[model samples]
Target: MSPNTSAGSKQHLAHSHAHEEDIPGTVNLNAAEGDDTGYGQALFPVPAEDPNDPLQWSNFKKTMILIICSFYSFLANAALIGPSPYIDLWAEEFDISPTKASELISYPNLAFGFGSLIFVPLYLKIGRRPVMLISLIIFCAGIIGASQCTTYGGLMAARVIHGFGSCVCEALPVQLVNDIFFLHERGERIGYYTVCLCLGTFASLPAGYILAGGYGWRLFFYVEFAFGAALLVLAFLFVEETSYDRKSAILMSMPATESEKASEVMGSQVLAEISETRIPPRKSFAKTLSLWGRVDNDVPFFTMMARSFTYFLVPQALWVIASFGINIGLLALAYSYTFPILITSPPYNWTVINSGLFAIAAVVGYALAVPFTSSSDRLAAYFTKRNNGIREAEMRLGVMLPAMLIGPAGIILYGVVAEKSLHWVLYFVGGALSYFAAYFYFSFTLAYAVDSYHSNTSEMLIAMNLGKQYVLPNIALILPL
Candidate 1:
């Protein structure tokens, strides 16, 4: 195992209340005799002997949930970054310097990070479904408000409101993926979520085209509002509450045969099925649609927020913070802040609409990288089988090596080409490569962190999100404004 993976795994094992997962991210992947060998391993987190456990949910249900959350990530981020090309235009309109107008995006972004401080803990308290629904409502309201605002200050306020509300869109998918999926499926599933999140940053391209098409900037927010409203409906219909508290059930059916002994993730010999107690039936659709679900009054809201500060000491958690923050600073910022300025300036004189083409390049880069989304999962599985079912969080990190090298090259290329005023294609090449690398780092490092530490997922996220947004050590907390 890589040092980082070993560290995370050791941390995971140390903190785990269950004995079965003694190795971090490690689980018995081998199926019991007569059971389907699709994953070839025992499920981790040892699903409760209850249908209501998110783990026991059918694939279709899990899939619909993933889709809803992924689209939420897309919708929230598109609105956040989509207005990038408007900096100059807004400057002209507001009778201010481009620097002042840039706050339209920057302050909203700052709010975006700050939102996680509140929402992650809120979800932990009120349950994911109600919080998600309420958040979407806030997001939609902000979008419509943005569309109607004529003053710079009014628009800024609207943007910040939506940004704060939409902030959970980033944290929820990872939380949900961990909540619903098994260890075997996490790396690949996170890939799917990561790709959508990356693509949303490209929303600037379409935003620019909308402006160029003569409907103007406000139309972009209107379009976003329509999409946000539609997503709210889909979320209500499909995104069931995933915050399940799976308690340990008494084991029942262990010795039908030696070969039939199911893998148990909890300590000691346990059966795959539960004993004695009556299992609760699955919630009905109408019940699932109810506004509220599980509420953990025990989870001290403010205390949870305060405890997040401790994760700063964890090496694995810090890696994710640095990885996300630097990528956000370097590539995302470069593309959003600098691309339009460069493309529309002296040498190229391209129209602002054409500046959005940089997003196309980012899309291409992410598309090329998307094929590798499952590579880490497959590679880790392969290595797990080799290691006698002991999977390290670092097992999937090998795939990130290529990305690490490729990402820096892309950053360097974009920077140098911009300095020399060289070919624009080279700049696009740089943007694509940087983001291509970003996808891997974003997905896998986070997976590693969660894999390393079994519980405290919400607190860990609080640390990660806040650290990335407001607390990078030497870097400016927000965007480099």
Candidate 2:
């Protein structure tokens, strides 16, 4: 069992999974003839008799949705962590200590998680499309505001605004994957989102080069603003409301078989069947771009925020929170905060401009891990087949074993290298190895959590956001850096 999953909590989680088909992730993969809409298997969460259903969207449209949301994830995270090298710069400019300047990044990171508290509920209640666009607009406003700020307080305020607004990027992509994709496709698609989210760290590389190019950190925010605006345009055009109600679904008729297709009588019969089914027409382009989208009148907003905290009691959710928090705070931020300080000071002093170079470790780590994005999904599918089409969330747990061990080793190597001031390459090597291993944890833990809580994923995301960013970072900040 992967340490990320709690074996002891299985009995505790029974109530959550009890309502689903047998188990939480369990689904019947066996379909009647001509009913296979999946990978030659039965489609889980079967599509309603409507073109408007997100599941029934065309592949190109689906890909576009994925692209836009993944891009949002990238921009949000880039804006969050890209300013690491500037901790010292901001300290000097604002006449504050480096630790105080770090709060510019840290406070925003807190807002990033806290933003999910409101936005997740908002998206759940109002629909993903409008919430996404509104969030991007808020994010863009904050980024541009940061570009023009001079005081530490003003900049911090702006940073918090953007962080909070953009944070919905994290929740939306995961929610979209669940909204649009089927069970067989979850791991791979979530992996793709994870790669983009990870690559956001790669923003530090360019942020450094911008400084090297004689531009101040403000230009970095300006650059982010530019991309944020462009993403807004894309989102406005393409991201339709994905909130769907499947409770009253009508079963769609299966496609005609070969023998039926060969018969004119059956062909006419199929046409009549389709006509009688009354599938709604696809929304018009103008309508798709409208500000008004889905609204769940029944989803109580504040109650959802209160209930989200309850998910913290669940083991799978806690695992995601702890792992993500440790990776982001202890691993990602530690490197980001320390690399510049170490590189620009005594003993192998390098130019301040090269401080962000360590991000390449993260880039390379995620690159090496990207190809295996779908491995867990494939593994689970294989297991589901073997088990007579009954799928389990734990099936993906096996792939996390190697990463679980290697990750700790990398963390140890990093600590030793930092303590001894070992060769700089070893530091990066540790970062790379740790991050490479973390990529699996980042991708699969989330996939597994979503699989485990097929019904209440929003609450799980709320716990993840709050625990990782709000809860862990505050505790981590108290430690001596």
TM-score of each: 0.85, 0.87
**Regions of candidate 1 where Cα sits further than 4 Å from its true position:** 1-19, 22-31, 34-38, 92-96, 248-278, 337-349, 415-422, 471-481
Local accuracy by lDDT, each model: 0.78, 0.80
lDDT of 1 by residue, 415-476 (tens): 89889999888988888888889889888888888887768888888788888775432354
On TM-score, the candidate that comes out on top is 2
Give, for candidate 1, the lowest lDDT window spanning 10 residues.
9-18
Off by over 4 Å in 2: 1-20, 37-40, 251-277, 337-352, 415-423, 478-481
Error of 2 at 284 (Å): 2.0
**In candidate 1, how many Å is residue 291 off?**
1.0
Candidate 1 Cα deviation (angstroms), residue 444: 1.1
